[model samples]
Target: MNLTTTTRQRWAWAFYDWANSAFITTVMVAFFPIFFRKYWANGLPSEDITLHLGTANALASVSIMLLAPFLGTVADQGGIKKPMMAAFVTLGVCATLGLTLVGESQWQWAMFAFVLAVVGFLGANIFYDSLLVDVAEEKDFNRVSALGYALGYLGGGLLFAVCVLLTLKPEWFGLVDKTAAVRWAFGITAAWWALFSIPLWLWVRERAPAQAVRPSLPVLLRQSVGQLRDTFRHIRQLRVVWLFLLAYWFYIDGVDTVILMSVDYGKALGFADDSLITALLITQFIAFPAALVFGWVGNQWGAKRGILAGLAGYVLITIMASRMENAQEFYLLAGSVGLVQGGVQALSRSLYASLIPAEQAAEFFGFYNMLGKFAAVLGPLLVGWVGVLTGSPRLGLLAVLLLFGLGAWLLWKVPRD
Candidate 1:
């Protein structure tokens, strides 16, 4: 295997981030929630829309959590991560395309489509992340991971900016109306996702397992179970890995929830969707360079310190967000989030990669993502429940600070690998 980094393969791997991020920003973050509230769930209370969003995210995470470990194990064992990645990518792209079919007063279908897209998005990402070991040497993990996220920020942000324009002023694009523009945005997302993914499929070569053998389904299942058991035992033995995951499970929960729920939170507080989109667009652009800078920070200060720095910023941001009284403050908070979000996440991925056994990258990352998805389940439910019960979105936003604080403290104690 070539240990030297190939620029072409590196970029190819990074482009997957570019591919899927459009769906995340445009469909998940920018427009879909607003569309759901105004169209599909029309006349429903704002709280109800929040509940539905939380429920959808939780359900998708639950589904992925249940299936991820087994699938990742099989892929690792069989040297089939790329094929599995292709399958999930196809699933996600199709589901995203399906969003074009959803119409006004069709919240059920919208929910169903969103769930499928999340499932595909998350499932593909597990394999994608695991491939980091395949594409780069151990020392390059931080930079490469950060590069992937940086490109994701750029790609997602660009598409989101265009989508926001189309939705806010369709006439600029010669569209008939905002509804048509929104639907076309879905098409753009699907196309962008598919187009960028081609580079990875064609260029980046997946690292093959040592021995490749075709096994019957029953045998594969048995092997997967045994592998899962051994991995769990190994994790228990590696106290740092276990502790790191526990810490990550907490911090990323806060991060992901903020990403998914921020627009809704801002909107509920009377901020315009256009302003929210513009603010977050700025976030994506800021995050692009910020992620790369964090990679350098991790190298200079250690991944733990870099992560701690980002989490500290998060704690301050979340607290300030809870007390913000106007849109300008919200925009400022959004920029802060951009500066740290990708950096924290990328550094965490590289840190975890360094801790795990490289041979079982796929299976290990599956558990990592499983814990991540499970955290998603809790974070949203926590924020949503508190928001509904307290009738104060500010209080709900405030509750997330606990997660960042706890995660940072736990992370500080971890020894450098």
Candidate 2:
């Protein structure tokens, strides 16, 4: 591809981050847990609510974790990454739109819709991450990966700001109340996801595989299963990738746990909903600039070192969070999270991209995403079950420190490039 064309494709690929992030920021991170606890499952005990929400997230992660490797293999073999992403994006958008119809005390229906949306959100990412190699040269991975995350932060934050305003000032938008505004936010999220995804579909092009084929679905399934088994053995031989994934599994779990559960944790401590929402909004905007800076950090210091620095920051943040007592402290913690969250995630992706064989990008990234989803499975359940058993959300939050500490130790052992 010519330089002008290649640059356009890279930006187009990055914009998918902008597209899907609205769902994550508006629906998943800020609104869903808040609405689930205060609206849908209003009368339930706090621990029970935590358990239910965690279970929904875990279920979605498990589904994606089980299927990502196989699906990745199929996408690589078929050269159909865009088509696969389209299917999941449709699923996620439709499920998010479904959230608008769920009425009060319908936590089950709410959970059902939330689960499907999460599945769609994460499933699309497997193909999305794999496309990094297609859109940018290997040497540009860190910069390009960070650009996607920075745009994700900006795009997700912008939409989330409007969604937050809709809740805070429903009259301004001609909505009936906060409940009505929340429902409207879900619909808006779906629309934003679909609208921004169009650029990716139209502009970003997938690289044709070396041995592309047009096998029927049944035949593709059979072949992919066999390929997945072989790839499993193949991964074992790639010691650096294997070790790095093990490290990512733990640190990213801590990261995902905090993102998903922080609002609920603040609520359990008696903080108001407005405070929790504002704190989260602060993180999104702060993350926008911080993500870009980390891309530069990855370039100057190396991806592994950049990741290690982020993990150290996370370790400190987690510890401080366990002792946090007020809204001001929550905001401080939120800002700290923003500083490290995107940096860690962006660098890890670029680092892995540098390590994997380009020809197997989809299949290898499938394994990467699988471990990420599996980490999601463990992280939430760990927090949820511990909160239920210990009757202390603080203790549950503190438990995440172990994952970060362990992950950092292992990451240190990986030889730097």
Candidate 3:
């Protein structure tokens, strides 16, 4: 690729993160979970609400784990990354927009909508992530990956701030109710994602040429299965990489669980919705610059070292969060998360990008994503289980420290190169 072409492709790829982040911010993190628990499932017990949400999320993760590798292989074979991404994004956007129809009386409908939206959101990421190699040289992957994540935070945060303002004062937006305002936010997220996805479809061409031998569906299936088997075999030879992945799996599980569950935990502890929302906003704003700083730091100290430093931050935050006594403290803890969240995650992606073969980027990223999903299941399940056993959410927060500690130990063993 020429200089101009490379620059355009990189920008297009990064913008996908910018585009879909609205859904992640508005629907997944900030508004919908609260909406689901409060209005959609009004009659349910708190435990049941938690369990149902957890189950829905877990199911979505499992579905993505099963499908992502095959989808990657198929995309690689058919040269259809752009189309696959389009299909999944449309599926996600439509499902998100459909949330407008959910009512206080329609819990089941809301649940199904959420499940579909989550599947679409996660499935779309498989193809989106695979486009990284096409966007930048190996030497520049860390910086480019960080740029994408920073844009993601900024874009998501901007939309989330708008949604928060509308949610807090729906009358200003000429909306009759807060619920309606929130519903409109979902619609906006869908539209935002759809519009931003257009550039990549139109401009960014795939780098790796498709194989000449196009197989039948049955043959494709057989080939993908064999590819998966070979992936496992190949991983066995990369012991250092495998170890780092295991470490990443555990630590990222803790990170993901904390992000997803912190709002609910705040609600349970009687913190106002505005307080939690403000904290999330803080994270978004802080993450934008911090991700770039982390990328620069990773380039100097090495990605693994940067990741270890972030893990240390996680351990400290988890301990402090476990002891929080007020909403103010929650905000403080949220600030800590903002400082490290994007940096850690972006560096991790860049590190993996360094280790994997360019040809196998999608297939290996599929494995990476699956393990991350599996970790998602484990972290939440453990937290929920611990909360049930101890009868205290604080104790469950402390339990997350174990993941960080274990991950740090394993990460320390990884070679810095």
Candidate 4:
């Protein structure tokens, strides 16, 4: 590829972050829980709604957790990462669009669509993340990885701001009410996701596998299964890789849980929907710059130290969350979260990329995303069940401290690159 083409490929690859983050910010982190509570699952007890939302998140994550590694092997063998990503993006877009059709008090159908959307969103990430190596050299990992996340925060936040406006001033958009505006927001988000994703499909190209002749489907499946077995053994033999994965599994659980549940938790504490949405917007915009700053931090101080610093911030954030009262306090916490959220995530990806064999990036990232999804499974459930059992969302939020503390301890043990 020529210089222009290479540059386009790298930018196109990063733009996928801009594409998918709309769903994560506008729907998953902001609107879904609010809509689920007020509209879809109306008349249900608060705790019951929290449990149901948690179940949906856990179910979606479990599905991806089980399939990520296997699918990674198949994609690596077939050299079909882009094709697989297209399939999942289609799934996610359609499912998100489907949400607009779910009428009032149809929480079951809403849950169904939400689960499938989550699956599509996460399933696509396995391929998306693996492409990082294809787009940039190892020396550029921190900078390029952080660039993608920065775009994500900006892109996701911009759309979310529009959505918030739609909800707050439905008359300005010619909508019937706030609910209609929210439904329209869902449809718009789907379109944004589909539209922004086209650049990646057209510009970025995956490196072909070594095999010249393409294997038949049956042969590919057999090879994939065998490769997966070998990959498992490879992970076991790679001490730093496995150790880092263990640490990622723990800390990212807390991160994912907070992102997924913060709006709901705020609502549970009696904050208004407007306040919650504003807080999310705060995080997104703040994280946009913070992610870039952390990229520099990773390059200068090392990814390990950058990640460890982020984890310490998270520990403090979690403790503050447990004691938060009023919207002002919630906003403070949201700003705090933004400062470290993208830094931790971007550094983690770059850090892991440095540790792993780039030849089998997809296969190893499978395990990376697998552990991520699995950690997600534990987090929402922990918060949900703890709330259900203790009848205090505060206590459930505090339980996340354990994950951050343990993860930080383990990460400290990993040798610096």
Candidate 5:
């Protein structure tokens, strides 16, 4: 019943990032693209696979965005951020584990499970993001956020490396085959995610206004709707935050699209799956320190400047991606992505945390996350559309340049805090 040390609480809070990221790096970013296309959709056209994945991504984002505001509002009203986070984390872990049960012929079930895991991972993040205010001192926010992301890169990258070895050399792991290794990767990811989540659940306090009375479902529904409307109005009134949201929406679209599609892009170019996996590994490993440095940069130069720098780097990275030819060049692109990916995301989180009122952290983070979820949906669809239309993923990647441009331009309008 004793409280954990502040340092312990901070580390524990950040460990959640370390925990759930295995699913992201291993499943979503690396193996899943290959698994879905080559395994689940083996007989289907590549275009069909692209369309289905895009649709699934959009649907998951939509569902999460719709509920994020209400969830945030209720968690704030009831002081239940910790418990809600726990529930979502559990959902994510279970869904990931479910993926292990899906056979290669069961693309439908695979997609269903994948969606549930994404929902759980991203949904849990709504509350987890809010907790930044609770766990970090004002001055340390950037560093803490950066460290979370840095460790996330390290932790996710380490597990993914193991998965890579298991898949590439199954006999070394005593697995029957690569397919079995892949299935076991799903279970390993789930277990890793679940195990690392324990610290924050036990140590981090949920700081929210206590609910005076528990409401009926109807009453809760009405309150949530009203809260959403009020939030919409309130957001429009905050010019800097509004402008930042607009900017973030655009640039982050490019970022999310790139992360989601990079492996698929390589596959389209006929790069071997092993090469793509190794390239992704390069990004994850290199990003660990790069993320921490960005945090330090934010601390010294301010988060705004740090984020803008990252955006500029991404603009270059996106343009370069379209020109990538073979595996070596792909590895170069992956490493470039590593240098900015974690830093940009971490800086953005801290920067937004600085702008919002701490008292309404969860509620406001809800709106923030909704905008983010909406952004996630936009990027992939645009990529898919461009790919389908031009018959080239290179052209599809070219489409993301505009997103970064608009995001940077809008971001410039927001004054530094």
Candidate 6:
């Protein structure tokens, strides 16, 4: 691709982040927990609801962890990354839009929809991430990754602001009730995802051409299995990459679980949905500029150093969050999270991209995603188990510091690109 074409394609790819982030912000992070607790689990005990949600999340993570690598391998070999991503995105968007039909009496349906959407969103990211190699030169990977994250923060933040406004003032939008307004917000997320996904489909041409790799289904399966085996066998040669993946797996778990579970944790401490939503909105906005700043810092210092600084901040925030006593503290925690979350994640992706081969990017990223999903199971389960056992979220929150510290140690050994 020429410079102009590459720039346009990169922006188109990044815009997908802008597009789908609304679902992540409005549906996954901000509103879904509130909807679950308030509307779904009306008669059930809070503990039971927490257990069920935790179990469902764990199950989804395990399922995705198992499937991601296989799908990534096939997509890479079959040259179907773009098509697979589109399918997953469509599936996720439809499932998100389906949230509109969920009602107080239909909590099960709502949870099911949420899980389906999560699966689609996460599964699609495997291929979406693999596209990085197609769009940018090695030197530009970090900046481009940062730009995508920055765009995601801004896009998600903008929609979150709108959703919060609509939620706070449903009557202003002529909605009959707050619940209906929230449902409308979900509908808007779906529409936004679908509409924004169009630019990538229209402009970012797929680089991998489909060729007839003739084999029966069984043969193809055997080949994929053999390739997986070979990849694992060769993993020793990729020791640095493996170490980075291991560190990323654990720390990102802490980051993702915190983002997903913070709202629930806040509610358990008596903060209302409005407060959590407002705090998340702050995170979204703060993360936009912070991502860019982190990108510059990564360029100036190094991705590893940038990630280390972010991890240090995470350790402090997680500890403080464990002891938080008021909504103000929650807002402070959210601000701290915004400052580091995108930077850590963006630099991690860029760092890995620099280490891996372009042709194997999808497969490696699939393994990366798998480890991430596998890690997702740990922090939440530990949190739920500890909270139930100890009757305090503080102990659970405190345990996350171990992950950060361990990740930092592992990261220290990863040689900088």
Please, what are the lDDT tens digits per residue for candidate 1 over residues 78-127? 88888998998899899988989998899999999999999999999999
lDDT of candidates 1 onward, in order: 0.89, 0.92, 0.83, 0.94, 0.87, 0.85
Candidate 3 deviant stretches above 4 angstroms: none
Give the CA lDDT, 0 to 100, for residue 207 in model 1: 73
Name every residue pair that clashes in candidate 6.
none
TM-scores for every candidate against the unseen true structure: 0.97, 0.99, 0.96, 0.99, 0.96, 0.96
Q: Quote model 5's TM-score.
A: 0.96
Cα-based lDDT at residue 242, candidate 4: 97
What is the C-alpha lDDT profile of model 5 across 1-417, one tens digit per residue? 233577888899999889988989998988888899988878987877887788778888998889898898877766778888889999989999998888876899889999999999989999999999998878999999999999899999999999988898999888999899999898999999999999998888766465577677677667767876887788899998888888888888788888888888888888998889989999999999999999999999999888889888998888887888789988998999999999889998999898887877888889888888898898888888889998988888888888889888988889884
Candidates sorted by lDDT, descending order? Answer: 4, 2, 1, 5, 6, 3
The alpha-carbon deviation from the true structure for residue 114 of candidate 5, after best TM-score superposition, in angstroms, is: 0.8
Tens-place lDDT digits, model 2, residues 224-339: 88989989999999888899999988889999999999988988999998899889889999999999999999999899999999999998998899999889999999999999
Model 2 lDDT vs. the true structure? Answer: 0.92
Q: On a 0 to 1 TM-score scale, where does candidate 3 land against the true structure? A: 0.96
Query: How far is 197's C-alpha from truth in model 4 (Å)?
Result: 0.6
What is the per-residue lDDT of model 3 for residues 46-106, given as tens digits with 9 covering 90 to 100?
7666666667777777888788877877776666777887888989999998999887858
Better of 1 and 5 by lDDT: 1
